[model samples]
Target: MARFDQAEGLRRMLAGPKPRVFTFLSALKEDEKSGMLVNLGVTLARQGNQVTMVDARASEDSIGAWLNASNDQTLLDVAQQQRTMKEAIKIVAAGLSVTMLTRNADCMAKLPPEGARQLSRVFDVVAHRSDLVIVDSEINLEAGFPLASLDDSELVIQVSADPDMIKAAYGLIKRVSNRLGRRGYGILVSGASEKEARLIYTNMAQAAGRYLAVPLHYVGNVPDDEHLRKAAHLGRSVIDAFPKARASLAFSRLAEQLAMSARTTLGIEGVPELGVGLGI
Candidate 1:
């Protein structure tokens, strides 16, 4: 709770004391989001922002399994009005030391209405904590449950990969644009080589700018490197494990862009009013 309540912790970096939220949403592809978040988490951590990476696709790091959350009530146990997001996040897991929420969205046909409500509130609390929250969700989006609640976030990142993946991602973007309105922003290129990714992104961005009138930027990418998979398997950040690698550096750059974008979007600078500045 120290970081959440500690305004000075952030003031040192910005002219204001408000927290910024950047949400990453991906189609239900396995590879796209997990890697994207791995890098995003490292970057946010490096930038002095306490980043909470949620496998919103719900991969098994749910609060129920954590001793930290078990000491209190789990997020699914809280009512929306009764929920205090700060306490929910305080329930830590092992390193990442992160609070991860993972679940298979494709099998929700059997879930009761109450079950759905609990899940919705869980994400709401997560959205409230930390400086930035990145969600890695399954591709199949239900109309009301997850997507509706995510509107609480400022920006949404829909990530995809390869030649076919590029087209698929754009299709998803064009569809989400109307429902999400103008705040619909940021296109992430994942698991693509520098040349292929650039060429594909150029075509997509040109199409979007000319038609949808949206400016898309690829903030993070994983160059099909094997080290990333190893780090994720070992539950360590690539930024720490492979600090000198190109992939890690690229991820860091992505985090920097995201941090700068959040600040610019929030209209903050010149040291936060909390009478402090960030050491970074």
Candidate 2:
């Protein structure tokens, strides 16, 4: 029997669009990133999308802890030929798998040619198996942003309504636009109501467009819900623990919009059907 070529399949999948990597850049706190990622991951999974979260943040603010996960193997292991991507993946929640990038955190930011190529291959394998791969990126002194990853994946800038945070967020956009040239980016406002979130996005978007010539897409926001806190304290996704909460609903809507938008823009022409199980 002729065997299927997994490597060729991954190459083709990367060439197409159904499966996408979305690297999130944020000036928010660690807890905020972890919370938002958990909510977003669970929400997308509930909506029948397989999700793989790359915890590339520093070890101190690791997303693994948020999901009660401890990584014995990480992407660094893959980089060093110690483990395969499959071995590195830790199933945290239903339909959510996480791979930590603890050792290669700095390299991910700097992304030397060899580092970038190896990391890209790791991401490609994960992307081929999942519908959406969310990379929680970290800031670096050398490389500034994860250029190698950000260059290829859809970029989303996460911010809150705090004045300092808003300023920092804009600064991040400016730096990226200057370095990467003008590009469209998605903005996700956390800790704000729908009205407030829109207002925040509008303010940032206007500034980005006027000054940097970078287009910002409002991907939606998570409201300030007590249920969110409760879910976090209980070590579960808000969507799973508080399905009717404002934050949960907001995440669900965002996931739906993103899925639709990606499919439309990327043109899921020849991709295999992702029979994602609705697991929340």
Off by over 4 Å in 1: 1-19, 60-74, 80-87, 90-128, 138-149, 152-161, 211-213, 266-280
Query: TM-score of every model?
Result: 0.66, 0.82
For model 2, the run of ten residues with the poorest summed lDDT: 268-277
How do the residues 38-117 of candidate 2 rate in per-residue lDDT, one tens digit apiece? 77888888788888888776465657766654565877668768887778888866678888765545545455556556
Cα shift from native, residue 92, model 2 (Å): 2.0
Structural RMSD, model 1: 9.6
lDDT of 1 by residue, 169-205 (tens): 7776666665554433555556556665556557877
Candidate 2 lDDT: 0.71
Q: Which ten residues in a row have the lowest lDDT in candidate 1?
A: 271-280
lDDT of 1: 0.52
